[model samples]
Target: MNKFKKSKEIKKIKKIHFMLFFIAFIIFIFLSFQNEEDILKKLDENVTFESIHYTGTLEIIRNNNKIIKTFECWAKNDLFLIIFKNPEDNGVKYLKKDGNLYVYFPSADDVLTISKSMMKQGFMGSDISNEDITRNRKLLDDYSIVSFNKIIEKDNIFYELTLQAKTKDVPYFMQKLIINSDFVAIKTEQYDLAKRLVKTIIVDEIKKFGSRYYPVKVTIQDGIKTSYKTIFSITDVSFNIPIDPKIFTIQNLYNK
Candidate 1:
């Protein structure tokens, strides 16, 4: 009888240990999936927009000098309009509509329809490509996430992802992005067809209004001289604002 009681107690203890192990395994799996989803969701949220309006300055450094051009920009879906406010380039406007981009020059009194080849050119003499900002493509929709790796450095943890374009229409062929917990992209590297690093965009400042966080300041560096860096800073911004019907039309762009 004593032996039987000892055997029963040993079995009860073993069962409890098995149950605890199983629960731990389940918890680990749940946490792993939840983190993966969060990583993807934050990256996807950046490219999705309804309508946005921002007044900002575009500082283009060329010939060892920084040229500051102030402007107001409006974007809705894939359409965009940029109107310059600087004295020299004042009243100059760029409009993107129906998969085409057009620039209206007040001085020339002429509207030049930008071609596909021109998309690779600098936007308003800045390091930013016209294709980069005017393309209505979302990162998650146009690219496949190759790897989502969480890295720990010192006290902060950052999420990094390698993205490959799903279609040729996408802006960048390959991209590597590192973002922090606040869903702010700290660093982004753009690659070309040869997998060569083409451009690097670094976010310097981020501002939160209501429920959304926006990059208020960013610096862009291309495959150029160190003094050729371009800085973009926003003064004021609002999301999903009401827009006039004629604001996006080509006719409005000409008269604008």
Candidate 2:
């Protein structure tokens, strides 16, 4: 009788330990899924904007020479217009509407369409590409998260995501995005289908606009040619502002 009682007590204790372990395992799985979902939500909020108006300064460095250009840009949803404000490029307009990119030259009074093949080419001889300027699609729109991990450095926390392109229309086949606690991507690495790194973009400085944080200073570098780089600075910016829809139309591009 004494032996039987001891055996029963040991079994009960073992069962309790197993139940505790199972509960902990379930909580861990739930938190894993929850963290991924929360991070995605934060990322979407960081990049989504109703309307954005900004003045940009591009400092393009090639070999040893530097060129400076300025432009005023307005974007609403999938439509955007970039008008060069510099003396040399004044009146040059780039418009993206209905998924097509068009360039308007005031001198010739002509509108030229940009082919998809040229999307990867440098924009205005800078490290940034035409697609980089006109792409308003969200990351999740064209990519699926293959894997992700949370990283803690000192007091800062970051989430690193490996994204695989879901559609062929995207510029990069694979991308690595490192986002900070604010859900802003601090660094992005673009890779080709061959798994070769093509480009890297880093947010050097960020600024707070109202209640939101935005990258005011960015550096883009060519992975193939390390000597080539571009520093893009947002001189002034306004987000979620009212913008005229007609401003994004091709007809408006030809105007003035």
Candidate 3:
């Protein structure tokens, strides 16, 4: 009788342990699924602004805070028309389409297509690149969210979103975007195929243009080059203005 009682007690303990483990496993799966669902909801929310036009002056600085380049930019939708206004490269025009880019030199009167390998290269010795300027923001159309979380910056008020490329042709296979409640992209990190950090862009000096806020200044840093910093400042801005579609074409580069 004593042996039988001891055996029964051991069986009860084993049963309890099994039940506890099963409960924990269920909770873990539930939480993981919930987190994924929340991220998808956030990404699906409306975040686009009304159609607008903007013009700004960009200043580029290199290592040692030396002024390296400057340009005047006119932009609408995903297209930007730039004229190098300083360092004797003025009146040049460039066009970015999808992930491809082209530059037209007035002196040569020729338009040259930029190679895909050169997309990561600096634009006219500035910190900005073809990818940075031509990044498509139609999140719902181009990419999908894999995960998202809030990141506390200096003020402890910011949100960071991580997105995985849905297609193989995307310029950067993985991307992390940081934005505030206002849907302004304060910072963005790009990753390559090996999941290595390639570039980081910081947007600051936000100002309200019309009813929406826009970043007036931006700084881009390459992880491979720690000492390099490219600062772009917007000196003038206009929003919600009319822009002709022809302005986005290469032929319109020379149009006032």
Candidate 4:
């Protein structure tokens, strides 16, 4: 009778251990999927817009030298048009449509297609690259979340996400993204294929446009040049506005 009682007690303890392990496993899976979905939703919310119009001012600073450029931008779906308004770059235009980038030089009165090789180069001597302006895709489309966690710092809550590129075609192979509670990207650190940090983007301010929060001021820093940085400020912005389809056409690239 004593032996039977001991055996029963041992079995009961083993069952309890198994149940605890199962519960832990389920919780782990739930959190893993839940966090990924939450991050994806936040990213999509920030980027989604039927159409948008904004006036952007760019301040490029290299060491002690600074240059300012202003432009009017309109974007819808995969199409966007940028027209420089500053005197130095006046009438110069860039149009992105059907996965291709086209530039119109006002002085030459010509439109030229930009090749993929040129996308990595600086845009008009600014720290920002051509790709940076033309890339309209969501980050999750090219990246897989490696890990994510909610962190609190300086009385603000942020979601820190580690992401790895799904393929080698992406410029940044890895990224550490920080998004605030408003679903706005507060900062992003981009890494190369070798896991070396290549660039960083920080959002300085955000404003609400209708129901969405948009970044009004941002700074981009290239890893190769510590002294080089670009500050992009959006002075006027409107989202979900009706835009004419002809505005994004190649023929309209040179039109005012």
Q: What are the Cα lDDT values of the candidates? A: 0.83, 0.89, 0.69, 0.88
> Which structure is stronger by TM-score: 3 or 4?
4
As for candidate 1, its clashing pairs are: none
Worst window of 10 by summed lDDT in candidate 3: 43-52
What is the clash count of model 4?
0
Expressed as tens digits, the lDDT of each residue in 1-256 for candidate 2 is 9999999999999999999999999999889866876787777777678999999999999989999999999989888889999999999998889888999999999999999899888888899899887787777778888888899999899999999999888889999989998888899999999989999999999887776778899999999999999999987788989998978888787778
Q: RMSDs, each prediction?
A: 4.9, 3.4, 6.2, 2.7
TM-score for every candidate vs. truth?
Answer: 0.82, 0.86, 0.70, 0.89
- Residues 143-163 of candidate 4: C-alpha lDDT, one tens digit per residue: 888888889999988888898
The pairs that clash in candidate 3 are none
Question: Can you list the residue pairs that collide in candidate 4?
Answer: none
* Candidate 4 local lDDT, residue 57: 93
* Model 1 whole-model lDDT (C-alpha atoms): 0.83
Best by TM-score: 4
Give the per-residue lDDT digits (tens) of candidate 1, residues 193-249: 788888899999988867667788999988546668899999778888887747887
lDDT of 1 at 149: 88
| Candidates ranked, most accurate by lDDT first | 2, 4, 1, 3
